[model samples]
Target: MSYSIVVDHVSFGWPDGTTVLDGLDAAFPAGRTGLIGVNGSGKSTLLKIIARELVPGSGSVSVSGEVGYLPQNVPLGAGRTVSDLLEISATRAALHAIEGGDAAEEHFAAVGDDWDVEERARAELDRLGLDHVGLDRTVGTLSGGESIMVALAAQLLKRPEVLLLDEPTNNLDLDARERLHAAVGAWQGVLVVVSHDRALLELVDQIAELRDGAVRMYGGNLARYEEQVAGEQEAAARLVRTAEGEVRRQARELVETRIKIDRNARTGRKAAENNRVPKIIAGARKRQAQVTAGRQRALAVEKLEEARERLNEAEQAVRDDAEIRIQLPGTEVPAGRTVLTLPLARAAGDDEQVAGVGGKVLETLVVRGPERIALLGPNGSGKTTLLKRIVRQGAQVPVRYLPQRLDLLDDRLSVLDNVRAVAPSASVNDVRARLARFLFRGDRANQAAGTLSGGERFRATLAALLSAEPPPQLLLLDEPTNNLDLASVRQLSQALSAYRGALIVVSHDLPFLETIGITRRLRQDRDGGLAES
Candidate 1:
């Protein structure tokens, strides 16, 4: 099959000597591919290498044609305009100069037959639902979602033969996410994206999984890839069971052989002492028997070791994603309890100042019981602000909020210390035990919170939140799945499953919301009204 991108025996490491990819090789055909792995698996680093934003320590990367890359975190430089981001400012300037009758050779040279750069840029922006964003507007003036869409639009306008995107759907609202997914689905060139956005991944032609320092390709989209992995895991599990039985049998036989040899030795010794045969002959027989027993024991021990080795190999075949297994505070807000009450309309009073939910009959936002609510809204719709207001005024129960930026943890503190800070009543051992459930075991728990990878930080932040002293009876999460890898998303969902509190999570990840068992869906409309969908 023809390939548009080829990575050959690539290896890379950070300046701190932390190894990322090692002798990695991968090839992408002229179709979209979903690149997925746990956080810290080098997904972003690999994309950077392919984009030539970072040089690999060894090997090389070759692309079929011009490459366009949209990094996960778009650098929103202050005072940089959208035209600058699109890289069409010069052409636009030249076009305007020519329109003004400045017959400069440099202007003509800069135009380079791209006189319609402005129109094309606008069209691309409109395609990505960025029509609301002006080309001359500074990036800093745009919302996070708007900036992402603009960055994506910049890459799309290049129309390069190869495109690389890292977490392109991050911070996007539902509308923006749909638009991005549509754009990705229509991509014709070699497109590869590193993202936990399941909807975007579902549009890919293949799934490339990065794990254990290697890349493995599967011949289908996210759902199909999951099916294939599930089948493989099932078969691997069967092999493990079979290998375990063989190891047990080998161990039992080894024990029996040793017992029999000991019995024989005792019998021979007793015979020699009783002088059943000449002592010299008995001694020779005993010596010969001892040699035979030694040889037998060695053979048995070898077989047992071989069986154990096979068992280990079989177990290795099973993928253990380091799933987080944690129990949230068992504090359940009663079903009839009024966890939070907010007048969403602008009319009520001081407490309801942060009001307005689209057109739904939600004149007042009243959250009761341990209801898991999915907060859906467009960019600039005030979802995050609403979450903050809830913390400030609404929630009657003990509450905690995890912001979208995940800046809750104290960077200087160790993970254990961070958790301890929130749950001071709990013993250090208790916090350590809880952190272990989040996969921060032993020394990992002692690492400074600032040193954690995206996934680790999320887990650590979550551990601290749930381990709060009084235990949150109402939890608010803003874009909780942002920057998380697929497995990390799963781990987050697992952690939330044990949370016995009312939750209001703002996110565009529909599949994630479904996994967390959201009981209700609330959308904040651009008109500042809250509606229940």
Candidate 2:
């Protein structure tokens, strides 16, 4: 079969001797490939290597055709416009037109020999759902989601033979993510996508899991991979149990034999005081001792060998089960009557009039103590906007909002400084202790928030929000599960379950929501009206 890209014995390591990928070999074909793994499992690093942004320390990567890449966070050049970025291609084409460059034939085929390139560019922008985004608009002025879409559109215009995308759905809402996924699904070229979204995985032709510095391709969807993992884990557990039982049995037998040898030796020594008969007995006792010793040695060797084998097997069984660690501290404050009430809350339209309004009037939505409520809805359904409004209206109640985007944090500040700034009165020792609770201990706390990985930054933000003096009687989280590894998500869920306050979370992860005990459902309509479901 023909391959678009091939990696032969590729190996990479950081300057600090941390091996990210080791002797990995894989081939990407002309179809969607979903790359799934833990947070730090080298998915992004491998993508970077394929994009030529980072060179591997060893091995070789061969590509059959041109490559287009969309990085995790698209860095828009300072003051650059959409037209400025896209016009470069047009300029190159015009130059090619004058000099009869190699690509001139392809350009003429795509557009007529005298076709208006500006019209084609505008049409491309519209096709990518950026019709309203003027070519003159500064890239900096665009939202995170908008910028990502535009970057993708730019790559699509290139019509490369292969495309590499790293967490393209990171900051996108439901609508935008769906649109992007559709565009990718329709592409007729080699596509490699690294993402954690299960919905996105369904669009891929094959799923490749990156774990333990190697890529293993599974011939199925995410659901099938999950089923396989579950079966493997069960098998591993059974093997471990059987091995443990065998070890225990061997230990008991060894102990019994040792005791029997000691007793026989004591009896033989007492009888040695007799005559010739006693000497014969002594000889027999010595022989028995040697036999017992041999048995014991054999048993010991067998036990050791069995244990080593079992350990190796167990390690392999659970190699992919690493979890993230996130601890959200709880406040000591007791919940009050009606933790939050939005009576006839509404947002005005562009004309300064109530575009659409609705009311949820109850005597009290009492969260007596430690009540966890999850807000569920589709994309652009106002889940986040509702949380923000609640925090604003309930100002008297100490509340902390952890936005999906951590942009509110100052990237220049150290993790410690960021936490300290949140609670200025907190002493350095106290701040350090709090940061440690969130897994940012020792020198990690001193690292800049910008330098921390996505998971680390998320934990730091949570630690800062939960470390206040009054300890926020209410916690407002917007898609807190995004970018977090499975382990960290579990840790946060456990902590929130134990919290003695109110929790209002916005998330699309149904399993996580169920784990946290979200009992209420809220739905928003196209007319901007909110209704309890």
Candidate 3:
């Protein structure tokens, strides 16, 4: 069978001697495939290798056609324009020069047969919801989500047979995410996207799970793959129970056989002492009993060993992660208590500007007791700025803000030290115990924040925020799922499940918002107004 991309026995390791992929073998056919895995599992690395951005230490990769890769972090310079990002600057320049009567052979050579490159680029940009973005606009002026969409447009313009995207939806807003989802649905070539976006994954033809240095392909979308895994785990658990029962039964039978053997030996001894039979005949009878007992014992032991092996195999199939579990009674707010209020700013003539988000002015806003509000808007709508303003305003109760950058922890300090810094009243053992619930145990808790991966750093930051001395009664989370993997997102959800506080979260993740039981959905308008959606 023909494959669009083939990775044959690829091996890769970092300069620090940390191995990633070891003799990995995988094939991507001509369709869209969503690559799903936990952070640091080599999904991005594999895509990089296939895109030729990074080379494998050993073995080879084969691609049938042109490959385009959109990295998780697109390099951008402030002075670079949208045209430059699309890689049509030179061609556009040449075309303009020719139009201005400088029709040099070099200009024609550059333009070639693609004179309408600019039109195509603009169309691609418009398709990705960048219709307002101009080719001459500087990259610095565009928001993070806009810049990403522009980069994607550049890739789409290339029209490569094989396209790779890593965390494409990391910085996207609701509208931008929808645009990306549409692009993924419209793609017709060999596409492999490394993302945790469930909506994006739902559009894929297949799901490939990268785990334990290998790839397992499931012939369906994310939901189907999850269903398959859940079924397998259930069967594995049942087999484990069955195997355990067999092991216990074998053990009991072994003990009973041994007891019977002992009784036979005692009987033989008694008969010999009483001279009930000839001495030689009695000795032979005793010898036969001993041999029979030995055989039975060996068979029983073998059966028990087999049962244990089956049980071990069955247990191996079940997958579980150490998730956070803690109740924060101090963080709970009363049902009718006021949590936060935004006072009116004097800048407004008749209408009071209570909050200014991206030049949009909110007349007034109030968040009360145990309310969970989802702050939603497009990128560049000033969600982050509004969050900062809210933080500055101060809450009636203790407030904790988890920024999108996850800058809550000191990089130089260990996870334990970071949490302890926020909760100075807690003892070191107490801090470590709490950190363990966040999946940082023993030496892991002692690791410097600088050394932690994206997900680990997020967890450490969260642990510090929630475990502060004065537990936060008002929690503000900004794009909490930005770079987190699916498992990490789930872990974060698990952690937040125990936080019984009033929350104001800015995120484009509608599914996550629903999961967290958002009581209200607020959208920031282009005119700088906040309204319930």
Q: Report the C-alpha displacement of residue 506, candidate 2, in angstroms.
A: 5.7
lDDT of 1 by residue, 399-481 (tens): 89998888989999999989988888898788889889988899999999989988889999988888887889999999989
Q: Candidate 2 has which clashing residue pairs, if any? A: 324-487, 324-488
lDDT scores in order: 0.88, 0.73, 0.88
TM-scores, all candidates, are 0.93, 0.74, 0.91
Q: Which 10-residue window of candidate 3 scores lowest in summed lDDT?
A: 349-358
TM-score-best of 1 and 2? 1
Q: Which candidate would rank higher by lDDT, 1 or 2?
A: 1
Write down the TM-score for model 1.
0.93
Evaluated against the true structure, the overall lDDT of model 2 is 0.73
User: Cα lDDT for residue 62, model 1?
Assistant: 91
CA deviation > 4 Å runs, candidate 2: 1-3, 87-89, 92-120, 267-288, 291-295, 319-336, 339-394, 404-468, 486-500, 504-533
State the displacement of the C-alpha of residue 249, model 1, in Å, after optimal TM-score superposition: 0.5
Tens-digit per-residue lDDT, 141-246, candidate 3: 9999999999999999999999999999997998899989999999999999998888999999999999888998898899999999889888988998998998
Query: Native-vs-model 3 lDDT?
Result: 0.88
